[model samples]
Target: MSIPLAERIRPKSLDEIVGQSHLMGEGKPLRRIIESGTIPNLIFYGPSGVGKTTIARFIAENANMTMYKLNGTSASVADIKQIIAETEMIGGMNGILLYLDEIQYLNKKQQQSLLEYIENGKITLISSTTENPYFYVYNAIISRSTVFEFKPVTPEQISPAIKRAFDLMAQDIGTEVMLEEGVVEHIARGCGGDVRKSINTVELCVLSAENGAKGELLVKMDTVRELTQRSNMRYDREGDEHYDILSALQKSIRGSDENAAIHYAARLIEAGDIISLCRRLLVIASEDVGLAYPMAVVITKSCVDSALQLGLPEARIPLAEAVIMLATSPKSNSAYMAMNNALEDVKNNGPLDFPRHLQNKHFDGADAKVRGQHYLYPHDYPDHWVKQQYLPDALKDRVYYEYGENKTEQAAKAYWAKVKGDKNG
Candidate 1:
């Protein structure tokens, strides 16, 4: 197969790169590193098509050292050893620059094989991973490398690359190629900040377009939409990026940003991971919206059930409802915090005996003193409540649940205060 347009048009120099201005911008750390001509062991971390591979290519072309490229998914120990063996021979001469892509796929042994060579400066390593390096790459590799993050290009940032690709396509066809309004922006926005994917998409649209009068290629909006229906959105359910979406969704809800919450919810929905979305929404209801709006837990449960029953497209409706409710709802973490605090004590302090009155009567042996004695049933009292020491003796004075500031929690707090006869409560 011919090389993909993304690879064909890949940036050869830092100047042609579309995004990651943070690292490649003027006087940026990476630019300075490259200009210094004394490259170090480096790790480029980010989603795909954001210039990790491009930067490595640029370095390989510019650096004086003999460059070797390997993909971690396919590169073996033998492959690494061969490179290292070669590097050792060339060590006192031109040196070696190794560009390893998807470095997270390299297990410990394969990664360790390069360590001695890298440490000795026989191999200048440039590794890239779509995963968070700390989570996936070995600690030794991380400690030895300076990490640069590549963020997705904004639509505006991607526009230039899209235009450049269109120009190239026109040249290939040996005719003028005219673009309909919004065609460039459509491709730019559709790739989810992926420059390579945008180029691929541009090639697809150009090839799919119909020839107009005078033998000119006319790219239209309809053709762009038809081909780009499934825009590139990087989502790995097991990866950190997926969890990031869940975190953003919950935080937006907790922060009461309804629009932001809806946006994240929509992203998850588009990713077609209803089960994860349902599970996270349910947790958010309890963990973030707990006690302040107690009914939120129940409502979220209902929404989750409806979503499961309805399935995607339709499922998104109930999920959107749940997300909006959570974002706009009064928020609190009082119950969640109390449970966590109590769990800490339970885990660290070890199991302790329950209060005599709270212990199960059946568990009481001839030492029945530990149960069934002086147990005052609350239902027999007015308001169906009574003050009793429910905590173990050592923890009897410890307070866990602090009432949240929401009106619902405040009212409950006031009622309990009256029942306890705490005048200052």
Candidate 2:
């Protein structure tokens, strides 16, 4: 079969590569390193279709080193050893560049095997991972290498390469290739920041294009739409994207941005990750919403139950309700904060005793060493509430549960202030 368009149009030089402006732009770290003509042991990290491999190939072409590509998924320690064994061969006369893709898959021992060759400068190990390298690649490998993250391409950044793909195809066919209005934008925006996916979309459109009356190719929006029906949502459920979405969801709710909260919830819904979605929404109700709206916990619980029973795409309704409710509701972390504060004291103080008055004991004679412990009963008082030391003696003055500023907590504060009079609230 013929080479795919994305591969056929792979960037031949640093200037041709698109996206990762933070690293690839003029005077950026990667550009400076490239200009210096020294390829260090490097780890290229981030999501797929983000040009990690393309840059590695560019380094090989420029460095004059024999590049041996080994995938961590299938390559054994023996494969690594064989590559190292080539260091003395004529192929290794200049230098050896080992491009190990999916470096996360290699066991620590397999990765350990590369340290000797790489440390001695015989093998320049350029590794790439779709997952976060910090969690996957060995720390030793990490310490010896300079890590550069390749980010997703924005539609604006990748538009030039998409135009190039069209121009290249037109040049080959010896005729003009016309793209329908919005076709480029659709392909660029829909491909989820993957350069290869965007290029492949263009190729498919061209293959399915019609011949115009002027002997030119005409690519239309309908073809682009059909080709990219499932392209927009791209993320590894096991990777950073998943956690980032979850974190964004909670933060948006905490910040009371209903629109952003709804948007992130919809993305997770599209991914069909109902479990994580429901769990995070529930946590937000308590951790973020807290006592500001006391009923949020119950309502969120009910919505989550409904979502679990109903399942998506039908479950999105209740899930959206819960998300919006938490986002728009008055927010307070008072309860969450109070629990944390109490926990800190418990941890730091070490084995604090509950006040004898608060301990569970029967009124029988054997219970209190036959002494008058006199734990006053609050029920005998006027309001069925009376001031007493609930905290241990050391923490008697340490107040933990402070009322939040929202109406709900302030009302409770007012009632307590009335009940407790001049003593406390």
Candidate 3:
């Protein structure tokens, strides 16, 4: 059977592995661990398609240790026990190494069983997980394992890997594929540092190119554009996708599209965007719903506080309630628009001078310089009504707030009209 392109090119040695130079660099902790020849039970935590498995294989090969591999997704407790027994019976100079991939899938009991084995140090344990171990692994198992975090592949690191792949393909196809400058960087960035995805995308693009008829098999920007346009929408913990979900939620609310709002909320919940969901709702309540529905802000704040108190799964309920309530409520963006308009004026035109009479009198020269400057104390006037320059001279006629015509805002408008006697009088 022919080996697949991805596997056929898998790095057989550390030098061949792309990215993860931090761990393999001179005097790095991982390098030290490998040199020591006796490694503590370890957990390799990172996103998928980076070189976790490759690094594990390199360690096993270099150490010349008896290796046993198991997928945590499929291995049962019985299988693990049997492997443990078999490992002990193996008569050889090399010690045993157990590599468990996706170890977070193991349940509490299975994790406990493995923890016991790791504690005894009879077999060295190295587990890989795409999930955050703190949430998935039992404390006992985590305590026994030394944790190593792997970062996503950077553009500079991925450049060489792409070049290496192109060179390999060139040998077989008898033609050079000339990638445009920064094309690989763009692909690497679009892949969001996923080496496996980057390599596969390049492979597909190269294969799609014309057969040996050109001066160079050029991978154009258009190819990358088309590839990334249809690429899977992935949620990266450290990337812009995290904030993109929040932006979508806020826009949906602002646009008054309840269905879109709810859909974005669901996406955030599914993507584990709990803290972000709570925070955005809190702001929306105060800034969008505002006094029009005072209770919305109250409910949103309660949801945020409760989520912080309870934490995930259970916390998701209060979060969902806030999302639904905010979505279904009478929508308004007046407050948001008001603040933004005022902010823009401030940023572009700079701060305006406050009316001297309204300035604080606590400072040394404030009382003498700012007192009796024709200030109208509204509380001391009839119906607490007075016409005074509340805004600065530069912004006297500038309208900042445009009240929504909701029931609550209309009522507020009536009260203000009675007080000011400016109700179309």
Candidate 4:
């Protein structure tokens, strides 16, 4: 029932803030902006527990504006209207700031609703989001606001905050609180630059420790390890960590490291990101495994089906099997590269015309020879293969797909060469 340690030690002033010296430090742009007493609509972009909301609160307090808070997830258009109405009642918005948390949760329609209010100076908006605001926030809102990126709080910055939490706890409980050697460092390093998490972890450890004879709580290293567990894996599906995990998984599979692939797959599974894993697996099967192992596509597709149907812990079985198959399969990016090269040409050239013989046959008399329909069927040839102009005139001699070192691709190259020779003869 007591206030959380994070809330109790929340920095009331910029000096009390432990990290983000880049912006909160002396003579920084943000510090100067605050001192000028002219707060603009702003965006604070960063990861969770990195003080995005705290900074917004600091701005509201320092600016001395009548501030209203809205959470983008639960608050609706009605809420915005209510805030506007309330602001109007309180002397028509001479100085007002609306602090919106998780602003990326609002859809374009909801974000668009704020433009008029923002333009008319009914309220100065301060928005916080874990996502890159440029991608998730409406462009209009982005254009009107100054964006400040908040980085992860370092271990040194968090250590002092952790010690402060202990001091506050001791004062509250009327007893001395002590930590075993290295426990603080363990937490500071393991928290991964999250001050709020470090504080909560220390609080949990303190609460779990047994009281001493003189009524002191002693948190030992084992208690710290037990309560804190291992280092928390930071993941936000809409944030940078999502792409990082995907990249790690793909590289592991491409490098034929089955163990690493499975490890990232497990991370995704634990994060409830099975769909992204399935999507990336399908791409890997076709892009990396290509003609070197055509069956890889079939295997991965089956795994995807099984995963979607089975789901969760049971689904991990097929997902893991597919990961191993893709990792162990011979790698080739020929198909992926070939398509990209061809697409680049198409995009740059603005859609070249197709060959006359290859044009779509839709008219009633489309097969007439006079209509340029003298196309030879491959079935009429010796090996059921024939050479014809399949590419446009400009790219007739262009070679998009190059054979890889795999036996299957080598055999394909040989078959194509033989077909060309027969046609020449």
Q: How well does model 1 score by local distance difference test? A: 0.84
- Whole-model lDDT per candidate: 0.84, 0.86, 0.76, 0.84
lDDT of 2 by residue, 98-209 (tens): 9999999999999999999999999999999877788889999999999998877888988999999998877766878999999988888887677887888777788789
Instruction: For candidate 1, report its TM-score.
Output: 0.66
Off by over 4 Å in 4: 15-40, 91-94, 131-156, 230-255, 271-309, 325-425
Candidate with the larger lDDT of 2 and 4 = 2
Q: TM-score per candidate, in order? A: 0.66, 0.66, 0.57, 0.66
Clashes of each: 0, 0, 0, 0
- In angstroms, how far off is 73's CA in candidate 1? 2.2
TM-score of 3: 0.57
What TM-score quantifies how close candidate 2 is to the native fold?
A: 0.66
Worst-scoring 10-residue span by lDDT in model 3: 232-241
Relative to the unseen true structure, what is the C-alpha lDDT of residue 47 in candidate 1, on a scale of 0 to 100? Answer: 75
Residue pair clashes in candidate 4: none
Reference-based TM-score, model 4:
0.66
Backbone clashes counted, model 2: 0
lDDT of 3 by residue, 147-238 (tens): 88887777777777777777777776778887777777787777756777777777777877654456668787888767854443443332
